[model samples]
Target: MLLLLIGFGSDSNKGNKSTKLTVNETFVTNDKGVATISGKTSPDYGVNIDNAKQTAADSDGKFSFEYNLKGNSKKSLRLEVSKDYDDNTKKSKLIYVKPSKKFLANRESLAQESSRAAVASKSQRKAASESSESQKKAESEKAKVESEQASDITRLSEKPTDEQSAILTQLANQTFSKKYPYKGSKIHTILGNIQPWTKDGNVWFAKYEATIANAFNAKRDATLEIRITPLSRDSGNVSFEDY
Candidate 1:
């Protein structure tokens, strides 16, 4: 990557912006022999692969392309970078694509890792659900003891304030946006319901459901739990995680 940057600089005029492109090691392949190449480049740069596949960078200069290497023995690729299809301003690089064996191995490893993660996530959600159930059960059992002599009573409060709702929504959006298909695909996060209950007054929890669509076109949904601990009347710390 550094060598490519230096070569680009040496080949470009001083006043002109040097063609800067870096291919991160995010290449992946499957048994079908198709490779997905992803990386970043200078913003607004036009990228072409072997003079066939072409794409323009996003506002942040990130780019991704999928190339089918099925049944091809040749392992080299030509990456050409330019702006507005100007050949005179193009910088080309010869990239030796990694062998399919490496990509397959990596894909297998990733599949295993994803399987493990799904299992772990399932366990975590189950545990959280059980914990919440037990807490509710304990509270119900304590209701008998909360007679006239009880010190204080827990209460169900109204919906969160605008500020609190905004903070929670922001946190949820960020968390959901960082997840899979939603990370890149044009997806909207629709927050469903907010259920908040408080005891004493310091710690509070708000549970909500979010629907993510892009990969499945709104057929899937996810539940999130947000914990809000108020430090004062107007401020607090908010944290959340996907379940």
Candidate 2:
């Protein structure tokens, strides 16, 4: 009877050992501070982490749980595994919980990229605004200069002096040469007509009928208008019309 009792006690101890819980040491968390705890225990055993609801181990004795560590100050978690058959509970080694190094690095990089994108967006908007203002100012100045030029052209001029007439004739000949570049082309004469002369703040205007001959010596009559800026005698506009 004594040997049988000892053997029974040994078998009871073996049964208790079979129900003990085991856990893997690898614990991981993300940048958002969610932690994963996983381990092994007797098949169908109830497993719980801290105050979380219990879950049953799988047929393979594997169990896993996720816990939000966002506001939790503790660096480790207590895991409990139990089996109803034995009415016993087992505690696992403390599972260390912390953000993974890779998670932290990725989060920091994302933040920096977001900051740089914001700055670049602001700079682009500023540059576009300044460019628009500059364009408007340039257009305004151009319109003002054009208005002044038109007013000058409408101002009356005294009768052309001999010197001015000579300048006008020379300009007409040069214009004819450029327009009809064939070597033999020439301007025969320039004759004054009504509304023939005018002057402006910066330029003189003359109109005349011109007789020209082309390279083939075919003569044609046309009206010509000439503008001369006395300050730069060679720089002005010349046009021919009324052929």
Candidate 3:
């Protein structure tokens, strides 16, 4: 602390060779918080706080503001400074008005804790994934003993398995063979392609069946899509819903 004070004193005695005006913070605490802008400059230097607001500067470039939290609060603070013979003014960094305690040690500790927490969370997620893989392997081994993978794949991939499709084709052939036996109605559409939901030796076929009696109004007409989708991979079950 003594060394720092001595160094600060030494810096004060140094000749003013810079005209840059800087504030302590880019953000302020309350709606109305003073910004202590202290810098080194010549004796006669002009510092502008706002765009054109009146400013006060001491012998050096040191300046301050006793701002108030007005109803129409300022979103940011713009500070600028200019010296004699200098054509342009140097603007300071945009000061965002926000709540800040200026606790350097606390901020550093919080950053460190956040990094540690992120590492710990990653480790926890890795452990959880490894545990899941182990459980999946165990379940696979047990399933191999009860059911054959080849048989399940063969039955699942069978084509033309829709209940409504088979029923409609069968009925159509029967009607054509009995009616003219030479001319038949064109099979244009199917309303619902009912599917069979099989599980635990029980086969439940769809109850509704619709045949496009004609091609008129076919685009607007809805077709029933049949599918056998697994409800849950673990349970080995499927449910059928018609739209």
Stretches of candidate 2 off by over 4 Å are 1-26, 30-36, 41-56, 65-96, 144-243
Candidates' RMSD to native: 34.6, 15.0, 18.2
Candidate 1 lDDT at 31 equals 59
- What would the per-residue lDDT of candidate 3 be over residues 1-243, giving only the tens digit for each residue? 455433343321222335554455444544234433444433456655565644556676566555543232334655555664354534344454443344333456677999999999999999999999999998999888445433332233323245423433444335434432333233233444344332222322233343332334332222333233322211222232323
lDDT of each: 0.60, 0.63, 0.44
On TM-score, the candidate that comes out on top is 2
TM-score for candidate 1, residues paired by index: 0.33
Q: Residue 232 in model 1: shift from native, Å?
A: 99
Sort all candidates by lDDT, best to worst. 2, 1, 3
Best-to-worst TM-score order: 2, 1, 3
Q: List TM-score per model, in order.
A: 0.33, 0.35, 0.28
Candidate 3 least-lDDT 10 residues: 229-238
What C-alpha lDDT, on a 0 to 100 scale, does residue 29 get in candidate 2?
A: 77
